[model samples]
Target: MLSVNSVLVPAEANVEVTFTSNMLVVYIDRHSKQVCLLPLDEKRQRKPKPYPFKVIAGLVEAEAVIKAQLDIPTYHLLEDSSFTTSRIVKRNERYQIISPIISEIHRYMFPRYGRSIVAQVAQKTGMQPTAIVRLMNMWFYGGQTINALLGDYSQVGITSPGKNARKVGAKRKNSPFVGRAITEQDIAKIRRFLNKYVLTRKIEEQMTLQGAYDEMLDLEYSTLLVAANGRKKVVAWSDDDIPSYSQFYYHARKYFDEQKKYPRQFQVTAAAYQKDHAGRTATIERINRPGELFQIDETPFDVVLVANRFSITGLCVGSPTLYLVYDVHSNLVVGIHLTLNPPSWEGMRQALLNAFLPKVSFVSGME
Candidate 1:
């Protein structure tokens, strides 16, 4: 561990000690969250020494100079927020330049000494000097020190393509069961077992994947013991022929895949989930006038009606369907019609007439 005084050198000091000139300078590539530690020349440019960096987790045992610069404790670099507070990592390979291009900036004494340093380094590296200068000044400032160059690895590997990018996990392999000797018949049996015993059951009563596997093993044993009347005797196989739990579970999972469009499990139990959880959107139209837009729909009332008021025999029991019409702008009920049967053309026509006709003593005989 370095004492605070040895590692904390004054920026204005012109002393040329062996380590001050030969020691590695720690800088953080903010865009990459990379902590680059490379040797610097007397001109404050990068030397052709080996540059090594690790993710935040790897920084716990880093040199005291690096930890002090990054304001991280010796125990764990991750717990410190001074350097990592809000910095995010860019994950695209396009943003990642070769480490040489990045670490070599320490070798060229640029705008600090003179403009010619940038030109000298650029001509040697075959890259535009302007880009080099921009990268160097990106984290460089007077009295900034080496610590300002530490990248924030807390949010490294961010790849979102918008105003606010976010961190994401590395992608998984295509499939874990790729080399297995699974066949169509094995997959079919697994699907049938899931559909019949697992998926069809109520959510509360559904069997777990392990429970289903055990049951299938029991079924396999029973099949070998008992033979059907007309069909050929079931062949008994060695215990080695049986599929492993992981193999069985993998095939069973296909039926319950959540990524499927309009998944059957959700469709069947939609009523149990809240309607708002469905993430549906509704459109509200803008109405300028009372009669500009009209909305019409029909529904059945809860009460049963006796429709044989004038019948000579007896009362006829029936459910009455009610048609409702409303003005969209004013939200007023303009028309209502009641009929013993379900909604029909006649019901619609009567409802329209009720809306258009004037309700007054002069129009008493209109109905």
Candidate 2:
């Protein structure tokens, strides 16, 4: 059977299309033998149209190669080994952001579901539908894998704030000072401020973007005024005297486009920072044998079971904790244990015993 991410190269020398088999089922009737093929191609539009699977099958039988069936090299294998740790981390982060969206729209990504599925998801998630669609398309075109999401960092060029006599960007509403133009000197000051306050390696010392902007204004543009009564006051600089916050932010992003860690304003928690930076120390080791490594975890199942199912007024029992042991090499579940009690040694022992023992038929009504 055709599976997800199966690349199909037609005999006619047309652009190759990847199959999204999850969406192949006919939505109108469940019993219908007629099914559609959700073929995605880079040159084709994002809209999913129903093409008869029989035609695709014929092409496959003739000469089309299901590339995924063969030992195709993955993104990690093809990626340059020269790439730095920071670049890899950034690519992973980008994938993390797009992963949730991909999962949300996986079944609806095909043409049979229509664009409304994307629109509905966008509305609920507060994301732009166009952006969501673009990401989806990128995933399909890039081999329907996380590696496809890695950005093209090959082109690195400095963007110069072109010399202008007057200020750039929209004027502030109801403000007399029509902002100062961003000069090379202003750009230099912005860089210094960003380095000192916003881009510090130490988390405790780092400042928010807005905080850094305020500090820049106070240090670089503020003036001390002395009145006739010998009273000294600090007068803030006008818009015309200093660069706007927008200008500062724009230059900061342009200059530090390849920043590994986000500033305080963008970071939600310390854990997020650790995930982006500190988490890279451990690399995934290649597993050669199924018995070489076994991973185990426990989670509360969604279902709740009662002490007695036959009684009308059965006490409400909480969800059972499910323990699973899986072979890391082949990703096959080796053992399982279900218990009403929370995670404990008993559950682990049972699961491990199940994994070590020979397989047997599980008959119903057996304790």
Candidate 3:
């Protein structure tokens, strides 16, 4: 005996098969006119019954008519041999295992009859009910073929990881608010509003969080509220499409930390940034070599100088101006000029001359 577990057929097509005690079961496709012979089982056969010559002749004639319609040739039949018999036995064994499943499925489609069908199939076939259900579902969805029920394996024939993992809402799409209260779009709007109003605007006018919240609420309601005078009152703000301040602030803070915190802190607290953050004082300069530059300035000496020597007592004198030139790179005194007269442009000219003159020749004494 031979039976079919499942077979792939076209839509609205039927399968025809004729069988008896010891003959092979041949399947004919009603639409395609193709014939498939099922392997026979000697163990399942009763005491060797005589061949049904009439049935065989009718099948042969049907096959010939199908071939004539398709314009294909027919081949000669071979005598029975041990090899053919063994192949039949193996195929029959597999068929017997899968026959009951096919019968149950044919009796009740899986969608119409689910667990009950699986339970009945399990009871009749002695197979795991879930396995039967899974196979049936695969068959219904995957071309209704026995091959669709087979498991995938690696090249080495090992079952792949998670191949048969339980499917618990696995095909569902992810929600934007999976771990949060608000969606990403709402959070983005809050951040953009915060940046435009809170951080980037005038620092002096920036309000605290509570003040901002109150302002937002006022702005929200003000647009909808009409004045009693009804003088064509107009308000530019509306909260009709806006979210709550709490939700807005939560995501606003997140975007703020990522975009604004560090830069804003630097700008707000940069009073002594050059000396503190930059690690350099205002008076310091980086010089590499000596005698690169010079500095010149004039100032009155603290001590008074003698102006007249003709008097018995030295006349009290005013302080004389002293001009000094120093090298900025080496910190050395490059030139000096002294005179009793108050400072003038000529005094500066002489100071410049003194800087270029020989040190030994350019001598000066206090008067």
Candidate 4:
């Protein structure tokens, strides 16, 4: 880089920085004719190479002395008497006469004399382009662009264009279900099953690449829910059919436990084991209509969440006896409410009336 010692007008300063000997990416304010000195930072350069640099410096000094003999031959030609008969040296031939270019001279001088920029840099630098970038990025507006992307993701919530991508780094997170791949043998089996059942489930023509993936995730997560792999989140597969093994051992137990408690519906319960190929499982149970046979079940749940103590008249009860009226056929809960006191038989009749009477009145109002 060549420096100009002169200063410009009142508010302006011009600095000359030569990028290469020939090429430069110039920065200028044309109005003021001011050349801005861009901010440059040195990020912890590496330690010096002491031994080799010292040795090289010694070698170049030694070579310079011996090369003075070879240069003497060219000197006689310039001396003018007998040498003038041969040829005269011209300004243009000065460059052609010297074999080594300036860049090449720098390369040799650095290794030989410990003075070249590239040699000292290679000893103490990583990727040169990347280092140049890091220095430049700290200057004008690099961090702002990065912060904007992070801020945008926070504002619009995308996890690979999803929820909480910024906060939790969900793009880097492991998939909830990993082994969703359809293997060679598994694909053959799935293809066979697809022909038989895919259309029945309306998945034959409508399934997409991601739909295929989702189906696999559901089947896979269902099957390997238990067999714990060494990873805390990973579930191991001890059997040949990994999905079937995990499902039968882990999920089946839960299904059976659920069925035992609800004995009357056990035979007609939704089968979740469609992919496992063992017993009937309830995965895709088609829900019935909005309201049918009213279910009478009282569940104790916390009401403090929906209604604060001040709104509840400050009764100070932790749990409320919530009378939930659900339709047995449709599985739709018509009403869920908490009355102040413990419910009795008389309260039950009133609860039913309080739950259904509103609907009857609303329909009559519509009529």
> Candidate 2 has which clashing residue pairs, if any?
48-111
**Model 3: runs farther than 4 Å from truth?**
1-290, 313-317, 343-346, 364-367
Q: Which candidate is the best by lDDT?
A: 2
Off by over 4 Å in 1: 1-283, 307-313, 361-367
Candidate No. with top TM-score: 2
Q: Give the clash total for candidate 4.
A: 15
lDDT of 3 at 219: 55
The TM-score between candidate 2 and the true structure equals 0.29
Assess each prediction's global lDDT (C-alpha) against the native.
0.51, 0.65, 0.49, 0.36
Candidate 2, 1-367: lDDT as tens digits = 5554455544445345344332222121123323334344345435344445565555566555443432323443466465678877866765665566566543453454546677676776677777666666655555566666665432244354444445656866877677766878888899888888878657777887888899999888899889999998888876677788888889878877766656766666778778775645578798998899999989987787776864588777778999999999899999888888888999999999888886665323344
Clashes of each: 7, 1, 0, 15
Better of 1 and 4 by lDDT: 1
Candidate 4 deviant stretches above 4 angstroms: 1-292, 302-318, 360-367
* Root-mean-square deviation per candidate: 23.4, 28.2, 29.2, 26.3
Residue pairs in steric clash, candidate 3? none
**Using TM-score as the measure, what is the rank order of every candidate, best first?**
2, 3, 1, 4
**Where is model 2 more than 4 Å wrong at Cα?**
1-3, 13-45, 63-75, 78-93, 104-106, 111-114, 124-127, 152-367
Candidate 1, clashing residue pairs? 27-149, 28-149, 28-150, 45-106, 45-107, 46-106, 46-107
